[model samples]
Target chain A: MADEHVEADNAEAIIARIEHKSRKIESLLKQYRPVEALKTALEGSPPNTRDERCKSANWIMVHRAIMAIKDVDGMFSSLDPEYYDILMKYLYRGLSTGDRPTCDQCLRIHEKLTERAGLGCILRSLSDTVNTV
Target chain B: MAAVEVHRFAQCITCHAWSPDRSMLAFCPNNNEVHIYTLMQSKWEKLHVLQKHDQIISGIDWSARSNKIVTSSHDRNSYVWNLEGSEWVPTLVILRLNRAALCVQWSPKENKFAVGSGAKTVCICYYEQENNWWVSKLIRKRHDSSVTSVAWHPNNILLATASTDGKCRIFSTYIKVVDAKESKTVSSSDAKFGELILQLDLSSSWAFGVRWSPSGNTLAYVGHNSMIYFVDEVGPSPLAQNVAFRDLPLRDVLFLSERLVVGVGFDCNPMVFAADERGIWSFIRFLGERRITSSGPKYGSQLSGAFRTLYGQPKHGLSNDTNDHSRPQGTVHENCINCIVPLGTSGSSKVMRFSTSGLDGKVVVWDLENQADLSEYF
Candidate 1:
């Protein structure tokens, strides 16, 4: 029973962290810093929490941050190579939404990302089952 | 330019190994039988067929010291072949596996071998003089999925395994009977058999090939996600680096020297990765020749031709999508390359030649000593 209490506390901590991260990302977007917002969204992406609500909420925040960007090339130019794999995962998640505009924007970003990061980005995003976005 | 020699052995090859002298070859023709071929009069001639496995042979390893060939198969069995007179005889290894054995490799000392299996266990088998047969000890319950490859450390006591569990693990296979009580190299000499030394979760996808450097200080493995990881300082606080590449995932990897590594797989090419003086590993270049784009008819013409064919205006009744075959063109191997074995003199620290076999039924020998482009990387 005590172990269950500890597990519940852990889950609540994860949910609170997700909300904090999402709000930070939104504030970055409002400050006209899409690149910084993308960096923040991809930092610890597909958050470690297994909670479905937290996952979808994080996804929505990531998607908004991704769609807000006007300069895809400029945003990618400053993006570090370390974030390429996580960004690719979020782009694939966007494509799977079946939302037309989201897919179009994702495709544009995917093409540019692939050109910059190469085929490993696509393979890593698709084959990684442990960290599903 | 590197000298590349290609030979078609069969319709498809699953795995291959070379004799101690590198004179003869043993390969599975994508089937249950293992075929031996010899270079007779400057040509590869069939020598013998070892038909023992009930299912497809998945792995083969030739021990240079003992001159024995060990093969594992999907039939849930393994065989150690020894030559008596001109005929080869097989000794069965009792690998207590409920699922298929995926890969096998003899230890560097040739005293024992390890087999990875679909049963999510690794069997470290050694010869028991009292039993007069090979017996295995299971390393159980650690792996969550099938083990894909097993590589023995140069120290002969440490074993590294790559698995579908998306992790590469280091285990101490120190059997008290076969190994000495005190060792100068490995720090964990007192660890019991099948003790987990370290586990690396660098790859988030299924890990395929795992290999140790000649000095046994570094470990490298490839993931299904087209990334290869190099781990240095195998003790506490190991340093790991992930080098992602721009091609299809590699099935196997080989170390040429302390700093150079060659990887081959579905790309049907061997790519070279090297570490700079700073010890950061990166993709260098492909050993295979670059594919030259054919200046054939444009896609617009092909689309119009397809339209004509749909309208029953067939010209010569040929399908418009003639170029849509699945085989990859303009590479040495038309299909996925499965195994790569170094073709160098045994005990040498540096390798200049290597042989690769693939699903395209071709074995290509590559001599990289004369490659001007690779000299800088070396």
Candidate 2:
């Protein structure tokens, strides 16, 4: 009976962790490519913990960024202005995570990526104007 | 999931295409105009409309590389409209053909196009960097009869031309594949003789539909007869000309995949059949009679009021509107389907089959994968 409660807590923890990280990633993508913002966002995140929780958090962030660019494969590598090694390392993290990070999160991130890429500036400005109205 | 139609058109849609990125759709309503619709703000917005095609538009083929559009018309003219251009552009005028053209198809590479002339000539229009528009090659000795259909291979330099001769032949622009001794690529003009591939004897029956497979290995054809035949291995194999048929009146044969072929016709029957060594009707079901758009033509108003008449404008009748279930159209001639073409890409074809139900035209685009009605022709 005690073991069942612990298992329930573990599931709850996993769900909460995913939800918390997803919201933060979405907010960062609302500003710019979540993948591009990683180095800065993770500047304060632990690098040495290597503990299961710490390593898992970093892996989740990297996974989030990779999901942001998964629609057009090989696009981030060729078009991104960021260092190739960081993005390459992120790909490894996504492969490590079994399931693809949610489609909705990727779409939210892609919408932000389009604005950063400078192809959809007019559309972004129109959206901004509508929100202001 | 709830049952509902996904995509619907605004005007009487005659032709359409999904963009290479699947972000946009190009369509023409045969209204002396062409328009591009993009999925913006979760709805369709007319991106651009160009005043083009002075005469009755025949068909529209989107280029493989970009958003460019090439349209052929019965006005004895063809135009290449650059999607990004501000004004209408007349790309080519093949002065050789005297009558209205039946069909026009762009090479899979989208760099070139082949148009069928009423005079039994197939003219090739290719792009030249100096001119900026595709100019004509005006190849002679095309087909003995008016060209009925044209299809380009998905990944090669091959082109197929089906004509009133009840024959469909293959052509190559850059490299010629002729079976003089055997199938070999030769670079000479003499070697480019569109090797007489497979010929289906539909002289008694009007062959209205023809499509090459996604892999371009086999060809599926449908005609006036209630039969669909698979002409296998069109590329230089001993089985290239072997014709096999599943005897059902098929108005059109859309080759969606290598093995899956779909057809629709007169009996208000919209069916999808698959092929391996033999063709089998995997999904056989009834679709309501064809759907006619308001912009479609009316019979007797144009010429002789007969459906089988040779030379006259195509007609739509009063019985095609299946929208009003109370006044449902009659299913008299269950096998008289004239044409079933999609407004978009024929290869990954999401479009429907079009046919005459009474005087009105009714079109039903089948979801080739699920073998279900995706949309009513409008």
DockQ (C-alpha based) per candidate is 0.39, 0.00
RMSD of 1: 5.9
Residue range with the least summed lDDT across 10 consecutive positions in model 2 chain B: B354-363
Candidate 2 segments whose C-alpha is farther than 4 A from its true place: A1-133, B1-13, B39-43, B85-90, B93-95, B174-190, B193-198, B235-251, B265-269, B276-283, B286-378
- Chain A TM-score by candidate, in order: 0.90, 0.39
Error of 1 at A95 (Å): 2.0
lDDT of 1 by residue, A39-132 (tens): 8877777777566776787788889889998999799778888898888998998999999999999999987886666665678889988888
Candidate 2 local lDDT, B223-262, one digit each (tens): 4434455666564452433222222344455654566655
Docking outcome class, model 2: incorrect
lDDT of 2 by residue, A18-113 (tens): 556657777877886644445443333333322355456656665556555543433444454333223333333444444555544444444433
Could you give candidate 1's per-residue lDDT for residues B257-343 as a string of tens digits?
889999988666688899999999998877755432133223344334324423434233234344434322335565677798989
